[model samples]
Target: MGFLPITKEECEARGWSQPDFVLITGDGYIDHPSFGTAIISRLLENRGYKVAVLAQPDWNSKKDFMRFGRPRLGFLVNAGNVDSMVNHYSVFKHKRRTDAYSPGGEAGKRPNRAVIVYSNRAREAYKDVPIIIGGLEASLRRLGHYDYWDDKVRRSVLLDAKADILVYGMGERAVVEIAEALDSGIEAKDIGWIRGTCVKAREIYMDEDTVLLPSFESIVASKKAYAESFALQYKNNDFITAKRLVEQYAEGLYVVQNPPQPPLETLELDDVYGLPYEGTYHPSYEEAGGIPAIKEVEFSIISSRGCFGGCAFCALTYHQGRQVRGRSKESIVKEGRRLAALPGFKGYIHDVGGPTANFRGPACKKQLTRGGCTHKDCLYPAPCSQLEVDHKEYLEILRALRSIEGVKKVFIRSGVRFDYVMADKSDEFLRELCKYHVSGTLKVAPEHISDRVLSYMHKPNKRVFEEFSSKYKKINEQLGLKQYLIPYLISSHPGSTLKDAVELAEFLSDNGFVPDQVQDFYPTPGTLATCMYYTELDPLTMERVYVAKTMEEKKMQRALIHFNKPENRELVRAALVKTGREDLFGKLLRGSGRTQNPYKKEPPLRNQKEKTRSSGNRGGQPLKKSNKRRS
Candidate 1:
C-alpha cells in the first residue's frame, strides 16, 4: 500500500454522503518524507473525516476535480512540494518522460464546486473555488521572488497561483483548526486570521514595498545578477530591500505568515512501527523492485520544527524559525518500541534525527523572559560569551531510547551540529552517543573550509568543526570502535568563488579525504542566498565578489572536489584548462599529459542476452499511488 491510500472512487463513494472534509494533493514525486501531505491526509482520516488524495495530479485539468466531488465541508489543496522554493521556482530540468502521469489512471480528479483549492495552479484553474494554497512552495514565495530557473522576479504564489490563502511550514495544526472553523459554518474568507498562513486582499501588508524585475532574457543573465544580489541581502535581516522590491515591482504583492507552526505532539509510531522498513541507500529502491543488501529500515520521525542555527543560505530558519518544539520523551520511546516489534526488525534502528539531531531543547533559557536570543549563532565568532550549555536532559532522552528492549543499536544518522556537541557540559553525553547510539560513521555539516566563505554563510569558524572532528575521532578510537567521520561540504555558495573552491579542494586533499561528494549551490527562494545571487553583495556588509553563474563554471567547481579521482580527472582537468589554470590542472589531475584515458569505459554491450538483462534490470517507475509529497 502507498503512504496514504485515498482513491478517487473512495472520495466519489463518500461524496454521495456528507463528510467533514476532503483533502486534495498535488504530489509531484512521492515517497519522500519531507512532504507533510501524507501525514496530514492520514491524520484527518484518523480523525474520522472522509479524505481522498489526488497523487501527482494534473491540477490544471478540469476532470481532476473528481477527487473532491461536492464535498459537504471544505477542500484542502496542498501542493505536496516540501518547500516554496521548488513550488514557486522551476526545476524542470530533472523532469523525466514518466513525470506526466498520475496514479490510478487519473480517475481521482476533483469535481467543480465551491471546493477549496490548495494546489499551486488555483489561480489558473478552479479560479472561483475557495482556493487555499499552503505548503513551503506557496508560503515562502507568498510574495514576489527571484525565480532562479525562470530568470525573473515573479509575484507571490498566492497571488500568482491565485489561491485565496497561503499556508506555510507544517500545516497539520492550522489545517485542523481550519477544518473546525469550516465545520462551524465560518466562511473561507474568515481564515485570514489563522496563524502560520498568508491570505491575499484581506491580509494587509505593513512591510515596505520594494520590487525589481529580474532580467528574463536568459537564465544565465538572471543567475548572474541574482547571484550578485543574493550576496548583498544575505544575513542583513533587512526586509526593507525585499519589501521595497515588492512594492515597486509588485505593488499588490503581500504575505501574511502568522506565528510559525507550533511544534506538534511527537508522532505516534503505532501506525508505522510495525511496517516493513527497508533501509536502502537509494531513496526508492523497493518500489523499483531492487532489494538492497543493507537496508536501514525504520520510519523517519521528526521531533521538532525549525533550526536555531541561522545559516544564511538555508531557507529552513526563515520559515520554520529558530525556536524549536520537541515531542515528549514518552512519545519518542513509544515509537521506538513499536518499531522494535516490526517484522523486519533486525535489532538495528536506522535513525532518530531532525534538522540538527542533538538540539532538543529551547534556544535559550532566557527565551521566555527576554523573547529568545536574537543572536544568530551560539558558537560562531567566539563561544557565546554569556550562554550556558546544557546537554543533561537531551542526553537523558538518548539514553532512555537506547534502553528500549528490542533495539540493539539506535543510530543518530541525521547531520549533527558538531559545535553544539562540543559545547555540552560533559563529554559523558558524547561517550554515551559513541557507546550506544552511533553505527560507525557520523554525518556532520562543515559546509565549507574557507573562513571568508564560512563567515559569509553565517557559519561557525572552520576551527570549531576541526576541534569537534578531532574530539569525535579520539573518542571513537578510545572506545575501540572501527568507524570513520563522513563530513558533508558544499561548493559555490554565494561568496565562494573558484579561489575559495580551490582552497577547499586543497584542504580536502591535504586532509587525505578524496572528496567523495559536493552539492552545487542552487538558488532556493526566500533564502539569503537567492538575494545574494541577485545582488552579489554581502547582505550585511554590502560587499561584492565574483559570482559563478555559468554551467561551465558550476561544473568546474563541482568537479574540483573530485579532480584527484581517475574517472573525473579529464573533465575536471579540461575545465581547469578552460579557466586558464593549466598549471594546477597537470598537478592535480593524473593522465593529463598522457593520451591514455583511465576514465574511459568499455563499449556498450552489443550481445543480445546481455542487452536484454541490462534493459530488464532498469529501475521500474515508483508506485504512483504514493501520498508522499516532495518539493
Candidate 2:
C-alpha cells in the first residue's frame, strides 16, 4: 500500500484488472506525506483508472516486474520516494557532481547509482511500458547541476533515470493530461506540449534555447540564485524566471508547465471528501528512508497545498502556488478514523497539516475564469483584497477530526503561518490551536529576526512573530497545555550579513530559544529569494545588497546563535575572531553551557599526508603552465 491506496472494489467497478499503472519509490520508506506517488496514484484512480503502488521494491532484481505482471495503462516512477531523494543541491549543483553523489542520507551512494538501479530494472522488466518520472528528485535533477562534492557538471535526471517522460511542478493537471493522452493512444514523445513536463528531442534551435536551456543544474550553484528562481515575490503568482527556465529548457526535455490548476470549486469538495480512504499505514514502510523527522512521526496527512508568505528561499509557492486547496472536513475526519483503527495504533495521530495548515481557501475567485489576474499579488507585493482571512472552516475540520473514534490526540505539526494567525486576532482560534493541535511544542518559521532580512525574504516582520509567540504563550498558559514555540530560523539569506545574523542571534538568546536549528541558506532554483541571494537585494525595492558566501563566515554566524553552549561557544569565538568580530566574543562567552545538541562525533583524519598536502596548498599559487605541462 502507498500513502493513499484505492479500494479493490473501486478498481473492479472501473473495469480495470489489477492496475494500469504501478508506482515506485526510493529510500524504501513508505508512510509519509501523500507526496508524488500518493497524489498521482489517487488522481488516476479517481478517473476509473487501475493503479497499484510498489512503495519500495527490492532493488536486487529487474525481474521485479513479475510482482505486478503487467498493467494495462503505464508506469509512474516517483524517485521522490526514499531511494531517489537528493539533498539541497540545485539542479545545476546536481549536474556538476561526478555522477549522482548526494551527501544527505540515501544520496552520495556512488555516482550514477540511483538512476542505474531504477532504469535497469524498468528496462529489463517493462521494456515497452511508458515510465514517467516526477517529484523533487526528478524535477530538480531534470537538468544539469553543479556537484559541490565532486566539483564537475553532470547531465539531467531524465538522461540518468532513463524514464520516458519527466513531469515538473505540482503534477496534478499535467498528470491528467498525460493520462488522457495515453488513454487516447498518444505516446510519451507527444507529452512535450503539456505544461510541467520535460521531454527529449534530437535537436533544438539556438536562439530559442533559453526556454529549453538544460541549465537547471548550472543555476542552483548559489542559494540566492535558487531563491530568486523559485521563491514567491509578493503579489506575484508565478516566479517569472523559474517559469522562463521551464519554458527554455523544456524544448529538448519534453517538459511542460501546464497552466496552474484552479482551486477546488465548492461543489467539487464533496466528491473529494467522499473518496474511500484507509488509514492503515503501508506495510513496506522501510523500503527506503532518510530525514529522521519523517521516521519520528507515526503518520501524516496533507490538509492543503501552497503558501502565501513569499519567502525567497522557499519553492513551494512557485510549484504549488499560493492559493490554498484543501480536502473537505468529512474527508479529513474519515482518514483520521481509519488511522485510529490500525492495530497497535497509539492514541496519538502524528500530524494533520499542509504548506500552511491554517490557510483554507483560494487566493481569489475572480482570477479563476479571467485567465489574467490584475491584482498586484498572484503576480507581485500587494495582497489581493479578494483573499479571505477565515479560520472558521479549518477550525471546524480540526475539531471534527479530533472527535473521530480511537484518535487520542491530533497534532498540527507542519509549517504554521504565525503572521496569518496574528491577523485573524481571534482569541477563540488561538486558544483552540494551543489546546488541541499542539503536543508540547509547535513549529513555526520566522526565517530571520532582522528587519531587513525579513523584508527581503517576504516574511512577516519579527515584531509579528514576537507578538504571536507572546500571545500563543498566554493561550498555552491559560489552557495548561505546557506548549512552546519552536521558531525556525534561516541564516545567510540574501541581504543577511554578519551584522544581521548577530542581531538574530541576540534576539534568539534573549528570547530563550537557544540551540535551535538554523539553516544555511541553500538557494533552490525558481525562487524569488534566489535573485536576492545572487544579487543581495533590498526586499522592498529589489536593489542590490551585500551578501556573505564563504563557509567560515557562515559557520561563525551559526555559532553565535548557540554561543550559550560550551561546544558552540568556542566555535563562535573562533569564527568571530576570524571574521574580525572578536569584540563580541567576550559577551558571547558569558553564558554557561546548559545542554548538548545532538551531533555525531567526527572521525579522525584518515591520512596525515593528505592533510599536510591540503594545508600546504591553502594559500599557494597555481602551478605554472610549464610545470603543469611537464607533469
- Give the top-scoring candidate (TM-score): 1
CA lDDT, every prediction?
0.54, 0.56
Candidate 1 residue lDDT tens string, 569-620: 5446556556566656535665333454434433433563443222212122
Regions more than 4 Å wrong, model 1: 1-5, 8-16, 28-35, 42-48, 58-60, 81-128, 202-297, 372-375, 574-587, 590-631
Q: Report how far residue 16 has shifted in candidate 1, in Å.
A: 6.5
Q: TM-score, each model?
A: 0.76, 0.74
RMSD after Cα superposition, model 2: 9.9
lDDT of 1 at 169: 64
For candidate 2, the lDDT comes to 0.56
In the range 1-631, model 2's lDDT, one tens digit per residue, is 2343334454456555667777665533233334355456666778877676654455678765446666666777765432232332322232222211111234343223454466557767878788888765565455554333344334566776777777766677677788899989888766666666777665544343234332444344544443333332223334222232342342444333333445444345445434443322354333433333333333555566656555566656545666556777767776677678768578787666666677776656653444324234431232445556678998898888788787778777666667777767467777888888777877788878888787677676777778888999888878877888776666667778887877776677677885345556655434556545554554335467777667566555655665675545545556555657656654566673533332323334456344323321212121111001000
Worst 10 residues of 1 by lDDT: 622-631
Give model 1 RMSD, 1 decimal: 7.6
